[model samples]
Target: MSDGRLPTRRRTVGWIVAVIVMLLLFAIGWVMVRGFGALSELQNVRHSVAQLHKAIDERAVDRADRIAPRIAQHTELAGDLTSDPIWRGFEFVPWLGQNFTAIREIAAIAGDAVDDAVTPIVALAADVDLTTLGLSGSRIDLVPLPKLADPLSGAASALAAADARARLIDLDGTLSLIADAVGETRSMIEDAASTVGALHGAATLLPGMLGSSEPRTYVIAVQNNAELRSHGGAAAAFIQVSAAGGTISVVRAASGLDVPALTEPLELDDAVLVLYGDGPWRIPRDMTSVPDFAAAGSLIAQRWQSQFGTAVDGVIAVDIDTMRHVLTATDAVQFDAFTATSDSITTVLTNDMPQAIPDPAAQDIAFSRAAQAVLGAALSSEEPSSLLAALSDAARDDRIRIWSAHEEEQDLLAASSLGGALPHDDDHDVHVGVLLNDRTGAPLDAYAAATITTAFGVCDGTPATQIRVTWTSAVPEEVAASAVAPEGGAPGDLRTLIAIYGPQGASARGGLTTTLDRRPVVQQDITIAPGESGTATATFTGAGSSDPLTRLHHTPMLEDPEILRADIDCG
Candidate 1:
């Protein structure tokens, strides 16, 4: 009985062992299948990545092929304009002559290139199906065959899911990079197109005006009055010649005035000269009524004697209001679209009115609205031919008060009175000679003053001095010295030293008083040749200092007017 029981127990143990072995084998087989599947999936993912890279490279090549020719053409056109002789003499002409057709072609080509490059990228960005790209059944072979049936199998599955998520994230990043490239390309193309279009438009009109046959010459006479000593007591006389065939020549004539200190007068050999001065003088608001303002105009004529050989052919004087009206009429004011503060826009708009518009806020808003309307109209217009005309008409109809005197008026009166006092031959050039004579019949000692107001209507605080009495001679050297005042308080005072303020100021003092300092100062000076009259000048220097009075101080006031007293004629 004992032997039979032992044999049965052994058989039961053998059966238990056999069942455990079969279970182990089955687990191992399942793990091998999953491992192989994961390897195949990884290989497929790698192939997709390669294909994406290849597509990117192909797109880049295709874009380059389309863009290179346009870029080359643009470069070539720029180079041609820069080197062209007709354009070089006057830069605006070549700019105006720029081929709009070529520019448009380049812009179109660039636009097309950008569009083509972005098309595929945009598609790829939109085509991605995030759900499909996720790996629900994907697995990684992290567990050994023996450990396939471990309780941590759930953790291993989670790791595999994490790896699949990582791959999808990588694909998303690649797509994002492609999308950015496409966007950059599109932006670049747009910018290029805008730049080209602007260049083309600017060039078109600039050259014609610059090279026009109309004479661009201007002659100005400046005076200084010692009594009304503000900005060197200066006044300005300007003559602009717009006629096609008019000839202007300035000669240095000898008149009784000092030479060495005054230097030589600049001879305007067919060139336009603009002169400005200060004085206790009057200017007529209307040129048609010359007699009404003759006394004031006489002062202008007197000032011209020092700088010009004769009376200028034409004169047109427009004050601050007129200037503002012209600018506004031309629609030249511009505003920044981005980052332009309301305060800044308001300031510009309000400050540019004819007489400081009563309600500044309302005026600024109105101006802005009007400007918008005009701009909108211009943009909407099918043809821009009338744009400039409209602007000019606005300026003309703005009722800007101006003073004008022309040679034609003077010539007509002279012709009617003289009948034949002046030669009538058309070929003979008309000369407007100015003769300087003192009341006592002695050499005249002329005192003059010139001033320059900058684009922003700021006057320089310095005064130029031309002293001594002798004959008027062409002294070109005096131009610089006469344009600005000496650094020292007195130009002739031997003891008075001229000092220059530098970027780092340990003032530089010089013994030479006649030499101009050219520093930023509102110049005012009284030139007295012992008992003779002299000239003064003021220039606007847009410089600022820490002192409030000196901060951006552009207006130079003439402090003394007794230098030009009628009873104190030096002659």
Candidate 2:
């Protein structure tokens, strides 16, 4: 019995040892399963990363290739605008306008391409699928194992990692290319936009020059002792136009006609007439020197007033170079031909017509010989009118020639036509005054007003400030007699006064007693430093005028010109 019991006990012990071994084996198997599962999941994550990298690289390369051509085109377009001769010629004509559409289109395309390339990548990143790759949860489920583990899993993971790194490198390179391309495209667009903007600004003035119903006339009145060619003395030409009647005339003032004394009123039928001449005639460069130009212009204006009983509204002067460039650029004549013809015409006009070009023979001879020959080859047609027409046509194109002389005329024309007029008074009278002063009350200089207009409104009456005064003429028929000042001295003495007059006797006044546009004048005090300037404004309403000139006449009067002195010391 004892022996049997001992054998049984040993068997029991062996069974216990077998159970312990089985438990150890099971633990090892479980550990292996979990380790493999985690590894597989990491491999899957890496695979997704590799795929994403590849997509990013491919898209970047595609985008760069797509935008490269457009970038090149935009660069070329920008270059052409600055360098192309045809474009330069086109600038002379205002109507051709600017070519901004092409630039805008290219910008739009580049913007769109960037959007398209980035959108898909962003979407793919946001909506990546992990469930299909058996990565639904954070922990791996060991119960759902495939019959055979993917033998290529490790190899695939290694390949994926390598591919991903390569793709990232490629992506980096492609992005750099894209950045360069975009930069080039943007630079080109900006250049084109700026050029187009300038062109547009210049072209905006054409309509005013061409579309005015009034006769656009210019009077070339010589103010100097320059020689004339027609009769061998001083020469001048009065270019006149009647838009309503479709009549144009060029009159030659008789030699020895006192240019300053010829301030006679001449009838211009609803026309914009500018009196100008060839001379170093003084013109005010700015408010500081306006008086000099204004005084000189005033003399000319007085001549018109003496002759026609009304002052001229506008005045301009041109040099010999100006005339040459205008004619040359418009006709597209070669430089040599333009120089010759211009010289000849200048000689004839300066030596002969010491007064004006009133003779038909002179006009015919001048136009037929030198002028026609210079213009003939330039125009498609041989008619003198055609040459003028060609010039007009060229002015409408967007081609700006860089000739300094022509640029001056263009600036002058733009100013005269578009810039508002200076202040004036009824009876076609205008007073333009400018004062320059140091920080103290001492006056340094004074200038004639080059521009005066009611458009500037009122004076704020701030000390040391420069003020502009304008007046409009009054027409007796337009306003009631009661509104008139009774032709005597003003009714009241006021610190500030403004009077407006218009065609047909329309008039209004403003001060402490009179109101502006029915609104009482508000006076405010402002302090100015010794070297600083300030302005005071007073406005008057309820005045009527037939034209801008007439309205200026009815505006107001500046009582103390010294009060509006400019601060010169501030500079």
Candidate 3:
């Protein structure tokens, strides 16, 4: 009886152990199945994203609309699979649960995007003809502009929501599965959102900005970077353009030479007045010494008002490179003097204009004529996409900077790189400026190139930043001798005012030197002979900025400055 009892008890214990092991195995299998299901759903969502993007690219709105809804469906399915409290609770289960959390978060964000972004974007694509916004024709079609505002607003909302969610993603763990996908989606979404927002704001403001209610006048300052100035090159020429009721026309074109002398004594910014001496009040060159374009813009508007007895609503600064971009888009433009094509526009405008025209005064005439002809062609051009692409390229290269006097319009521009305002250092980015203000009073800067080198070190428990700017004059001696200068200035002297800006909160000190003089000083008038070079060095301490990255801000010059990053021996 004792043996029989022992055997029965042993069998019961073995059965109980077998049941517990089976339960553990089942739990593991469930989690595995749940995680895999979530991954599969995520792949479906990604597939939908790809399809939608393809539809948008092809401008197949119906396809996009169909694909858009599927994203929401797949995201919901994935969301439900992972959002179950039991599955979510597995998040603490080490390596197995990370993918679940990632899919959950991504699905949630993607769901918000589908609701706020996808439908509206499809609507935008269907309703608006993108080429019309290029201002390709003489008159802007204002009808679709208003229609775009809603979808654009929705897209922006979706992007903001997605970005907020993306920020919360644990990139080190769960998101490793779709890191590139997540990153690319976020980047593309942010960029598209910004573009849409800008377009929406512009659409809302453009009718009035273009003087839909009444006629508005604007001064288009043509900056020539041949002689590098604070804002591109000298505003060597000015074109007065007017718009009324969505129709734009070039009213008149004038060289900076013809700007009427300032009759009314004007109140000018001290920096402008100090750096650029009291010269004939020409708006084109007036801003060459100042960095803040808004200030220059105001001065330009004021000067235009003073000279022409009419107030300008805004200032648009375009450079020779921008003209070339337009020419490229239009293929080529022809005037009585010559054809302005992309291939030859830069050289013809900068190098050959004076020689071909053989008259310094008429060189401005040739330049203006070529520019006006290009403008005329663009206004009449049938290819809106090409023209818009050209303008986009120019703006990206900092060749097109603008400032509007209208508060609303300027506010819109402030959100754009084309606003031409110095960036505020709220994020404590290491800001170092190596700017050249041409004092040679000539276009000799065409031959000048700059090299800026920076290194980082720690000093007394804080980061120390050092900068050096080397200016080289590659002008041939003959070219230097023949260079044209502002009426009263010498031709051969490549005099430049080197304004060095350091990081905010950092105490800075530096000076200039030249190959001619081996000694460096705290400050000196910078003068480089033709075919020579000069250097400026500055050191900054106490910036308290921990960011190792540095950014240099300067006016876009003819020759792109060479940038070098070097490590400091922290010893």
Candidate 4:
């Protein structure tokens, strides 16, 4: 009887084990199906969203309108597929759950972003004729701008939240491929958030500043790469522009030397004063020497008002590279005394003009002519949207710095890369700055290039680091005597004002023409003979954080400077 009972129990146990195995297999198979479907939908969402962006950028409203709905549909489907009971249950599995959780959350975030941001932004984009906003014939229709402000702001906020949620997804313990996909998703969300936020900032500020309601005066200072300043270079020319009721025109043009120095220094930030002193404040040409465009812009505005009696609402600074972009966009641009297409503008402005017209003051007038020509062409360009895109690219490269006397507008500008403000310690990354000013007082920098590198050290925590800058002067000694000597600098030699701002709270010890500087900011006056090289170093201590990301910031150089970061000196 006992043997019979034991045999029955064994058979029952076998049946129960077989049933459990089948159920487990079915659940796994169903989860796989759901995952692949969700993946397909998510892929569709990405494609639609990408196409929608391209359409909006190209101002193809009809195409964007068609693509916009597809994004929302795919996003919703992906979210639903990922959130189903079987898939959601698998998200709790101990070892492999991180990947599941990440995918589910990413789908949800995408869906929410579509609902909260993409739909409304697309609708608003359709309402605005972007070409009209792109400065058509020296005029822009500002009416659509104000209407766009709110929706763009809302979209920016939604995407910002999506960015935050995406970053929080844990990729640890996930499959390698899943982790890579999730990381890329996070990066894309982050980039979208940043870009939209900048656009929102622009929308909020541009209308009022461009004189939608009242007349406004703006000073556009064209910085020359010839004589590099901390922010870019000395303002070689000034174009005074006036705008009212969506129409704008150049009011006047002047050389940077045309504006006389201030009789008395305007107020300065203690840090700024400590570094550059009254130089940037007193000499309108030297305004950019301070590296803080806000301060530089304010002083220039004051100087222009004092000189010409027109109070500027804002100051915009552009370099030769930026103007080249503008000229490229406005293909029919014509210049006098020298031929300059976008391809030849850099040579025309920096090298050819200096050689052709040697007098510093006269050279400046010629540069001013070039600036005026580009502005005129841009204002009347047939493809103003292309001009707008070019200017936007220049801004992204930090080649354009803007300042507004209006406090509210200035606040927004200060928060962006183009503001040219020194970053504080508490900003996202550990920051180090290398500012270069050509003390040669000539367009010598156009003939030179800079190479900058930061050597990160490891202390106990966030290690203090050192920034090394080497300036190479390519000017033929003969040309230096011919070109730079006229500006009262040593013939055949390059003199430079190198300002180094270390991590905000760090102390610095330095070498090679450096004077012991105030905490975190070091200043050096270096002279490199023509066809020679000069180097300087700023060593910092106590600059590290628990989690440190080092960022090197610099003024716009004639040739885009190369930046290198290396880990060294761990001991």
Index of the highest-lDDT prediction = 4
lDDT score for residue 425 of model 4: 51
TM agreement with the true structure for every prediction: 0.18, 0.24, 0.73, 0.79
Instruction: Give the backbone clash total of model 3.
Output: 0
Q: For residues 1-571, could you state the per-residue lDDT of candidate 1 as single tens digits?
A: 3554558788899989999898757644553343334233323323333343344334444443444444334433333333333323322333322222222222233333323333333233232211111111111111121122222223223333332222221111223433343233333443333322222222231222222344333332221111111111112123322222222222222111211112222222111111112112222111111111222334334444444545433322222222232333233434332111223322343233312343423333444343333333333433222333333332232211112244443333233211112112111121110111111111111222222111112123322111111211121232223222223323221111011121111111222121112232121233332233333222222222111112111111121112220111111
- lDDT against the true structure, each candidate: 0.27, 0.29, 0.68, 0.77
> Residue-wise lDDT of candidate 3 within 1-571, one digit each (tens)?
3544557788899999999999878866786787677667767776777787677656788888888888888777867777776667777778756655665677677667667877777777776655347365877866567767666766776676576556556545544555655555555445455555556665777788777778888898887777677778777678889988778899888876666556443555444444455541344465644566776787788877776888899888888888888887676777656766888887777776755665655766666677688788888778775776677668767777778888978886876677876655544334566657776766667778888777777656766776667888777766666776544445665777766666665665333322111111122247787778898666666653334556667668866799886664334
lDDT of 2 by residue, 1-571 (tens): 3554557788899999999999767754653343334333323323333344344334444443444444334323433333333334333444322222222223333333323322332333233321111112111222222211232223223333332222221111223433343334444333323322232332332223222334333333321112111111122322211111222333223212223332222322111111122221221111111112333333344444454454343333322233333454333333322234444444443333322344433432342233323323432323333333233333222111111112443453333211113332333332322222111111110111113323322233311111233212221221212121222222110111122112222222233322222323223222222223344333333322212212121111111122222222211
**lDDT of predicted model 2:** 0.29
Worst 10 residues of 2 by lDDT: 440-449
Candidate 1, superposed: residue stretches over 4 Å from native: 1-243, 246-291, 308-311, 329-571
Report the lDDT of model 4 for residue 523: 73
Number of the top candidate by TM-score? 4
lDDT of 1 at 309: 48
TM-score of 4: 0.79
* Candidate 3 TM-score, true structure as reference: 0.73
